[model samples]
Target: MKKTMKDQKMVLIILLSNIFIAFLGIGLVIPVMPSFMNLMHLTGQTMGYLVAVFAMAQLIMSPFTGRWVDRYGRKKMIIIGLFLFAVSELIFGLGTNVSVLYIARVLGGISAAFIMPGVTAYIADVTSDEERPQAMGYMSAAISTGFIIGPGIGGFLAEYGIRMPFLFAAAIAFVACVSSIFVLKEPLTKTQLAEIAANAKQANFISDFKRSLQPLYFIAFIIVFVLAFGLSAYETVFSLFSDHKFGFTPKDIAVIITISSIFGVIVQIFLFGKMVDRLGEKKLIQICLIAGAILAAVSTMISGFWTVLTVTCFIFLAFDLLRPALTTFLSRAAGIEQGFVAGMNSTYTSLGNIVGPALGGILFDVNINFPYLFSAVIIVIGLGITIFWKEKQLG
Candidate 1:
């Protein structure tokens, strides 16, 4: 069935809105998390472990959530995920203990595992190959916009109290949740539904997972892992680096994140998908990875607020473009099992999250700039993987 323009527009709005709210909650916490932990009297490895815990939870649950979306429906998974996110946010408000906060993050991670893959699969279901890259870009831009707003708002509110940000984040999520329930529609076609039904009944999780490890998928996985890893590492160390190098306050760093987020939105919304459609995601991925790596390496050479901020904005643009194209390519590659396939993509990302922040934290204790340099090395390796990886004829 040919989709109407209205259907496409509605789905686009719904998907973008969902992503916007989710990231709003996340970005709000990013600037304040280390300080929040300090309030609980935690530091060092404990904080690193907390970061790992969030990623680890997502890694553990993503595959199951993906499969569940395949068997059930994307809409169902989305609503459930958002509901869980609401609960997680409430948990944050209910406690001041580090242990309780850790549990909230774990819950948040699980919610994320479900929400992200489900939304990707839903967009895949609605959009044609020709339209998909652009749609993905728009969704990514919505996320970047949230990143821009959330940090600034969170930082401002944090002066009153950290818990206030949590309350505000949750309130925003609740509003989005209500909008999702009424506004989002399931867009899967009959053939797509049948395809999922057939695959869902007989596919062995372990066997199918092993078989899904084609060179293209493997390359895509590596690309996503490196991208996520590098970004997470940067985020984990940003506050620390800003403080040490430029004596930046939390509010100042929040402003940096907000500005970088604006660059990220421009790149994702205006540049990325169209660039990929014109140049191909494969070439764009290669270019962005190389450029990002170079920029990251250069970031280590800079000191003080202005230089760091300049490089950070460039890095954000590089990152914003790379991720959407990577995800769009991976979703297209999944063929009939889009949810499960997309889930694996999320799993690899979570794996990167688990590794990047932990390693960055450990390296930070050793030297402040090592993490950035290390991220450059990882990106180069991913670019090399993309070179030899064969492209599969998806769909």
Candidate 2:
């Protein structure tokens, strides 16, 4: 029997909700981390290195995890990934030193590599071409909201003690894991499995790996990289920015991010799908990229918290629009090879994350606004690439 639309919607709801919860656990810890480490007497270099390790783990493991998803199935990966995530959160909650925290983060990265690609592939499997952008947009909004609330909640917890945030994070992950166990189901069709196997046989793994590097895929990759670079810089340095500019506390920064995320969510829910349908992916990407460049440049010049907050809402909305469009473009480029495409998507984002913070930290040592300028340049380059990017090659 064919499934009803309600069944498909339920699957989307369950998968996205679990993703939101998982991200919330990570987001909760990020804002208070430097403060937590400061209490433990770790230096900035140590903290940066610890964060780098997490990105490094994801970079190394994601391709293999993506392949496993193609071969094995989404539900299996989701369950195992959620269990690993819970274990990592447990370790993080009980962690006492920078080294222990590093271990927890590395494990968390591995678990995330599994879950993120698996969920994305699941979305690609179930949705039609027409619905893909909107569905992905919803998932992106869920993730952004998790970022919005998690830090505020973490900041409130941090007022008690440094360790409190991790305990809270662990509790969140456990709930997500439990929910996923019952709620998330594999969506792989028999035809889809056969197609993946046939593709696996038709093209040698090496050639397919190289084919995955298509020009259109590069367009998607550059967008992912540029977006991640900008956003990661914002995430890593925003606390410092708020503190220096406004003498704000962690909670204050949380409020600012939460407000910005509200804008992000609205754009994703209401604007992203319609814009993609109307403007098409190419035009949509180009417009968002240009807007993002302008926003980054403006952000460097802003001073007051209220002004920054207002500007940030628009900036995040630009980001929210870019994210789903680019993801849908990449998924289309994959066609039947959902795992490889989703894996590449995650890998580029992680690569950008790796570059963003390290570069932002270097620029920070020179000037507070340097990171924003750096982000603006990267965004402009991405815009140029979008203009020349070949869409026909993708399909």
Candidate 3:
């Protein structure tokens, strides 16, 4: 029993590490966006397109990847995803034109489609129902940790060159890919694999997706979408906003994001599970949405580095808590459809990512404060949905 428990812990660690590497690759580019814009001679709208393109590709691929993870097994897909991530980062690092950048973003999106659902389903496979929330919280923390570390490292590296960070991200992803190839084990047993194979043969994609999209799941999807949209809006324009408002350089923006993500990691690791246990997913979701809305509104009015940092920390903390809570809620509601539901969740999030940045970029071009105000309104709509949503509908 102790040996089995030890194995589980080891597997969880590897999974968490893999997720951390993937997110680190994504976040490493954030602090360098201003540099990219300058080099590419791009405007806010074009920059938005660059961000949205990645999510659009991910949105297109997520459902298919979810099914593929079940069919091909999680370990295989994860390694492939990591390899693709490395390729994408390398392409972006070496590219000289917008077309190449777009291609790289598309590759990144494809990688995420495979990685997100694969990692999520792998976690679900290894954890018992009771342990799932905490496990998901840990996963969220891993992601937040990547966000915390990536920007700081990228900022420091950007002194060398803007493109240097992308190269570093590629190197990190390549190492992760190699590690996954040798060290990661499939979580599913032979019997479970056979069962999943049988179910895959029996289930059509459309039917399975429809089944997963029942009213409760739909509400969960909306929450996921709203969270993604609001956060993306804040993030997409943040570098531009800070640069315009406070004359923040890439390093300054990186510091703010890194500090905000640090508090987020702490909240996810230490407070998220406890809050979920006490408040329940529904109530917690509501609370986070309300807090996020208020924060978004207040953010537009704030100035100075310290004040911005203080508000952003709370905003990120709320988002961190909201994510795990929503994941737990959806997972519990999913029961036998873990992979499908996880894929759908990613799809919803990708959809929001597609819309949010596009809108945010246009809004940022209009006025710096518009994006934040827009995000607040979106959060309020999500809150309204949550209020009217009946918990009993889940059954």
Candidate 4:
């Protein structure tokens, strides 16, 4: 059958569903992490390592996964990725030991490595350049929406059992997996296929990584890494920070996260595309980096409930805007190498995530406010790097 524009829209929705469902598992875990720390007798450092392990796995797999999506087809990778996502969530739901949780985290990271780049490349295949920013905005909204709902539901689910939300996440991922098998189609066109085939001989991760290191691409990857690192300083340590310093309950964490994420989703859906067009990626990135740095520092000083909530909302909003703007920038710059660039983006992000939380965890042990304060410093460094980035290079 000849695909209609409506059919293309349906495929995009399905692709976004894969992203939403995968991140939903991550969101579900955030609210219940303090309980997890208690259950497993974990330290701030160990918890930090736990988050890092996932990113480590992603970092290890992303270069390979990037090539796979281009070589094997986006549809195949999406199905396999979702299947792994289900299994990872299932393990997390059932495991009692930290070892088991680590294994699950590894599989979850691998699944993300497969899914994110595959979905991103698929969307790039189907959309025109003019349409991509809005399409990517909706994709970002799906991820934020997952975060919006998951923590709130996770807070309630934890009341029944700390493991309940993971099981629910597993079930939902499986459903998405099954639906993708039946419903999702490969959107790659003849031109993209030819480009993939041309890059086929040089398929090694080393070569791919080297290819991605061109002047135009290298700085973007650095920004992605720095962004993840800075965000992790706030995120991976957030629950522990709040519970220890402020005596917040799971529900309080849930309320703050869900509310903040809702605001992120609103701007992503309604404003992001317009903002990208008017401001351009470079300006949006610079603005958000400044916002993130200032807010991270500000977050360290605030302790009152309402004040913390306000700062956190801005933090989340800046990050939400920054991520898509970066992704849109890379996608526009990549030309025929969408999957390759997406994979590299994930790789750098994983590298940042690996380092950020692990360091933040150690710093958290020394001082409760240290992690976010450090994040402010990291984001300023990223902003400094961005000063070298010129808008004309993308064309």
The best candidate by lDDT is 4
lDDT tens digits, residues 254-347, model 4? 6787788888899899999899889888989999999999999888777878888889998999998988888888998987677788889999
Q: Tens digits of per-residue lDDT for model 1 on 131-242?
A: 7888788878887787778777788888888778888888877787788889887666657667787867453556545655766577788788898899999887988988
Q: How big is the RMSD of model 4?
A: 2.8
Per-residue lDDT of 316-361 in model 2, one digit per residue for the tens? 8888888888888888878777777787678888989999988887
Supply every candidate's count of residue pairs whose N, Cα or C atoms clash at under 3 angstroms: 0, 0, 0, 0
Worst 10 residues of 3 by lDDT: 1-10
Q: Estimate each model's TM-score.
A: 0.90, 0.90, 0.88, 0.90
Each model's C-alpha lDDT?
A: 0.81, 0.80, 0.84, 0.85
**Residue-level lDDT for 86 in candidate 4:** 95
- Candidate 3, backbone clash total: 0
The list of candidate 3 runs beyond 4 A from truth reads 1-7, 33-47, 96-98, 158-163, 200-212, 242-252, 303-305, 365-368, 392-395
- Distance from true position, residue 349, model 1, in Å? 0.7
TM-score of 4: 0.90
